[model samples]
Target: MKILLHNLTRFGDLLQSQPALAELAGQGHRVAVACLENFAGAAALLPEAEVILPLPGSRFLAGLDGDWRQALAAMDGYVRHVKEVFDPDAAVNLTPALAARLLARRLCGEAVRGFSLDAHGFRHESSLWAAFLEASSAARGLSPFNVVDLFRKAAGVGLGPGRFALRRPEAPALEAARLALADRAPEGAAGYVGFQLGASATARQWPPDAFARLGEGLWQGLGVLPVLLGGPGEKALAAAYRETCRAPSADLVGATDLPALAATLCHLKLLVTNDTGTLHLAAGLGLPSLSIFLATAQPFDTGPYREGCLCLEPDMPCHPCPFGLPCPIGHACRRAIGPDTVLGAATTFLAGGGFPAGGYPGARAWLSGFDRAGFMDMTSLSGHGETARAVWLRLSRRVLRQFLDEEPLAPAGQERFALPAAVHDPLAEQLAQSADLLRLLAGHAGLAGRNPAMKDRFLATWERIRGLWTASPQLGAVGRLWQRDAQRAEPDLPSLIARIERYAALVAAFADRLTRR
Candidate 1:
């Protein structure tokens, strides 16, 4: 099979999708990728891709400002060229944007998976995992699966050992990177530690002063020099770091391109960075990283893909904040993680010792690893007891994996489900309601094909069930999966009935498990 993947996203996302692409290639399929022109260079890092198509998104949009007809013509020409060069048997769109959906439809018609548009211009999600991703976008904090896992699942790839890595740059690029580093750093430093100075969003960035303080501590305590890294846009942050700390450091901000950055990361002892593209690049290079997650960033979903990487996030109720929303408390999560905490983690990791076993008052620590099923997993190092939200998130993950992957559920003690009254009571009520609705839908589904009134009643009951689950954050995963199965089973009354009964059994079993616990 010739599979074409459409990922019109940024640098970090492109790097993260490597496992999915590699899986497609490993399965004896020829993989081609279509990405934005600006990050086309990044596509070279994916060794699995046999063909690379760079879409002139920026240039086309730039042309639209002056001449709309010319822009359309150029876009059409590019589309034709893509279709002619690598005619794909299947298309998987990793981007959820409208333009990407339309392009995927044009490229492979009904064979497109993930998100795409129908012939009537109606949006469609072709897989259960895709629907789950769509639902996760709305309830961010509740999602327990890593995005890399979701991408592979959406692309119809099975979960396996996540050992995929980026292709290293050429020998010349590596040598140039080494020479650049040698010229910048002082002669007698023990080794280099990277400080990634910027992130894609301000909310996700750690304070520059904190980084400077950490740098100074690492130099004074561990005999390592701090090598600052960022794109040209982060020069201001670089200046701020220089002004804040009196430590000896080398600033390579805006000095190197993507390939050079990867080559340079190979020499680092460790990378201490905000949640950014550089973090992903360093992970791709197999460089150990200690990444800070704040505001809308969390380690569970978008942490570095490599196992044994360290991740830190502020321990706040409002953490992993919703996207595009202003912080109600003035981004206090920024102050939650102090420089001392990070320096300790950095030193501990460097010494070949794991994270300190002590509790972090305002922050949490996690070590990245793969679970038994080879999905990216995080083990908390903070000694604090699990919160109610964490319990629900864990349960949600188990339930979804059981339904989607046929994984077996482990037996747990009643204490595991001992959520607070405030959380448990309402959730129990909602699950009961959902179970009842599923039963009603399943009972009526068999009669729907023969009787018009029965069909109307069955449809109404189904919508009610949808509304009930959609409104509850805890049950939204089940709703999303059920929605996908129901959509796929439509026009077949027996199949739809089977789906409804299966979901009913799932809810009933879950409710029984909770009750027994």
Candidate 2:
């Protein structure tokens, strides 16, 4: 059977979706993927796709300041091209964009999944697709499955441990990358550690100063060479790091293309990078990597796909928003994971060193690739059109309304919202934290998806808060009780809820202050 998959998302998303693409091909089915021209380079590295259909870059269909007829007409041509030449027995639109939905409807395929337009041309997603995509959003702290599994489930394929299969890097590019590295740092050619200084979002990118400190520490302490890598967007950050870094380092950012980049990653001893496409590539290549997950980057969702790979993320309420929401107080999550923590992680990976564990406050370390059963899985993350804050806001508002014993806005005569009421502030960050604790407690009690990581997160968080809430007796007592219950082999649900409500009431009191009477 010929299966067509259209992945019109960004580069990292394209890289993460490869496991399923490889799976369909490995099953002896003819597989074709509609690749965006921009990501055609990454798409070329896929292991087994019988056909690759190139779609024009996003620039082609971008709306003009005035008339958009010309662009619309051109888009119709691309749609016609796909329908005429290589339509498949099955099609799946991996992206949730409206344009992709409309195009999926136009494509000639008998069984189409994922985002599509129905008979009425309204956007639609399969129940499985909806659930899978939702797994990556703000409620990820509550989600039991990884995104790579979600992708397989969305495609109607059997799920288990996933693998990322990639074609070998082009020999020429591989050699070219080696030569470039040699020219930059002749003493330690392939023994260097590459730093990816850029992520798709600035929110997710670790601060340049932290990388500079880490690079210096790696060179000064571990006798390891530091090599930097990124696209054009990272040039400024790369330059900043180069200026501040005291140790000898090579700034290879923007110098290598995707093929050469892949080639170079093979030579490196390890990569310490932001949560980006390159991180996924390194994982696919079986490279030992340390990925930093800061603001809006969730480690559990898109952490490395292999064991022995490490991840560093701040244990803050706002660290893992799907959209990379801006921090009001600045990038606290990125700043919290200082150079010392990264240095410790790097040294442990390199010079056979035992670094101090979990010394840094507000930061946590995670080893990727293993599930509860100890199998390698290619984990990925996805988001519905909602943020974590959005979910929390709704939940907070609904529960708060229930507490108030009346709906704030109800039909009064002809007006639906005639009543004057204060818009209830969800106090999302507070609510999200409450939710995280509850989730952890549930996992620890074996009531929810119990796992090692869940316990680690719960313990780490419990320890952090146990001290800070000393002033608030009610909150502190409830939290201590919750922690005490979590340590038990079997936790009592009724007792847990009583304590949970004690903590919830405290948070609700703050929300109550913000709520207009």
Candidate 3:
């Protein structure tokens, strides 16, 4: 299967999506991905990907003088390019921006899948779905899964529930990286501690002094060399840390591209950095890294997914989403996690006592060597037209109308949407297929799907409720799938009302889970 992973966000976001593309390739599917111009270096980690497209204008949107029109045009160009070249079996929209998802869906046509945040209301999601329905509306087009799981589901492959694994660069690149480090600081060439002092903005960054202290400790106590890495914007910050810190270190910030940095991090024994792309890059390159999260971002999205790393957050009432405001109390969160915690993790990892190839103790070994037999059993190439036709037929707005509730255009409608068809139709097919692939792969390893019966029951319940909702005019039109199916002029309104009960139960179950903790 040919898969196109579209990310119109930041370089960090592009790096994060690498795990998803890897998941597809691990399952033996041909995968290509798009990133903003600046993030092209990160795409190099995805050797399995067939093509890496760049949306230059989208990269511009990440900066201070960002423009929405240029970002949209770049996103459109990337989508059209993928549509013409890959003609992907599935298109995964991984950008967080709702507008990007909307435009990308139009450009990709049908066979699209992606995620949406539950902002405003379910109706906002519905509006998005309406656009999606126009593209490809399967039984349940959009899946409400986490970012990582979204790709797994999109690829129609089961990675066996293991931690995400990133591939190392070519041997020559790796060797060159090591030599580059030795040139930077000859005496501490045995091993170095990697540091990233700058992030996209102040909100996501830790205090420079905090990084300085950590670097100082790594040098004085662990005898580890401190190597600061960041973009050109971070040069001064890295230089400042190198000057003020007690340790002997070199500032490589703003000095290297993604590939160079990734290759270099591969040779480093450990990485201590803020919540930024470098943190993720280190993990992807198999470096033992510790990530310090500011109160503005949550660990659920930014924490290191690999082992041999520690994620530290301060105890604060006003946390997670600072909403563009700096911590008023002099950034206590940064001060609390402390340099000792980072240094301790680094010492334990390099000593090889706690960290292993598979990561920390008890961590499962990563999936390696693409399993041909397992993939064969799970998926087979269908006639190009057969799958495309099936996909096209499924992308109906009327069909998508079953999953939404109320019209998104009236009253409080921001016309927000969820899984747009341009994003979900192709993805759901892949997800449905992933169930089979997961079962096949796990079967080889004496493993079985977890909660199989739960999924079965859920699907059964979902179908029944959907049938009921679709049967009545009231339910079909405004009860369930109204908001998401913008193209659906008429829906079974009564069926939608009937299906509301199921949604209520789902909300209740979700609340119960949250309440239990």
Candidate 4:
């Protein structure tokens, strides 16, 4: 089969999709990748792709010089050219943007999977996993799967045990990187450790002074030379690190391009970074990484995809905060994690002593590993007891995964997820109410099959149920799961009733478990 994989997102997101691309190609599919032109250079890392279609996104925007018609023409012509060239048997759109959706529909018509548009220009999700991705985004902090696993499921591929090996840099680039590192470091240093000094968002970035402290600690204690890495845009951050730390270090922030950066990463003993593209890049190169996730960044959702990587996040409740919103508490999450804590973790990691057993006061640490089902999972090293929110999120993941995988719901364990009475009562009531609505909808559907007049009542009841899920955050994922199942069971009363019953059972199970707690 010929597959056109579409990803027009950031550098990190594009890199995350490489495993799925590799799986498709390994399965004997002729894979072609369509990505934005600016990120076309990164596409070289995805060697599984037989063809690279770099969409001229900037050129299209530039053509929009107050004339919408010209931009539209250019976009249409480009889409046509892509369709004619690849003519894929199917297209999997990993991007959720409007432009990418429309382009997928134009290129593959109904043969497109993931997000796309119907004939009437209405949004359509061609898979349950895609709907889960959309719904999970609306209710943050609830997702238990990494974005990489979700992307693979969306593209109808199985999760791999490890990340795909990215294309290595040329010999010249490798030699240049090695020479550059040797020139910067002192003679007979232990090894080089990379420091990714920048992130996509300011809130997500660790303080430069903190990085400097950590770097100095590593240099003095472990004899490892710190090598700074980031895109040219992070020159200011590199300068900040230089200003604060008087220790011997190499600053390659604005020096290396993508390939050179990869080459440099290949030489590193380990990388200490914020949540950034460089971390993902290091993961692809099989480099050990210790990542700090702050503000809107959380390890559970977007951590490095490889095993044994360490991740740290603030233990505050407001962590993994909503995007585009200013921090109300003056960015306390950033200050919560101190440089000493990171230094200790890094030292332990480098020494192969594993993470410390005790918890940090205001921070938590996790080690990345694959779960039994082959999905990326983070095991807490902080040794703290699970909170009610953590238990709820874990259970939600288990139930949803079981249902989606068509496995039986595992029996409830003796452990309790103790929520305060005030919070527990309302949530239990909502689950019970949702279950009742599902039963009613199922009965109405069964009756409507014989009596045409009952159809209106069934529709009205469904609208009310939709309103229920919309208003309740706990039911958001359940609603998405049911929506996908319901769509597949259309016009078949028996199948529809069975699906409704199964959905009702799911909701009732939640209610039952809540009452048991």
On TM-score, the candidate that comes out on top is 1
Candidate 2 regions exceeding 4 Å error are 63-67, 134-142, 186-190, 321-326, 353-362, 372-517
lDDT of 4 by residue, 246-270 (tens): 6789999889988889999999989
Scored by CA lDDT, what does every candidate get?
0.82, 0.64, 0.53, 0.82
Q: Give lDDT: candidate 2, residue 257.
A: 83
Candidate 2 per-residue lDDT over residues 262-314, each given as its tens digit? 99998898999998889989988888888888776666567766666777777
On a 0 to 1 TM-score scale, where does candidate 3 land against the true structure? 0.63
**Arranged by TM-score, best first:** 1, 4, 2, 3
Candidate 1 residue 274 C-alpha distance from true site, Å? 1.5
Give the CA lDDT, 0 to 100, for residue 253 in model 2.
82
Better of 2 and 3 by TM-score: 2
How many residue pairs clash in model 1? 0
Off by over 4 Å in 3: 26-28, 58-84, 96-99, 115-146, 150-163, 186-190, 355-490, 510-517
Collision pairs in model 1: none
TM-score, each model? 0.91, 0.69, 0.63, 0.91
Kindly provide the TM-score of model 2 when superposed on the true structure, using C-alpha atoms: 0.69
By lDDT, is 1 or 2 better? Answer: 1
Identify the superior model by lDDT, candidate 2 or candidate 3: 2
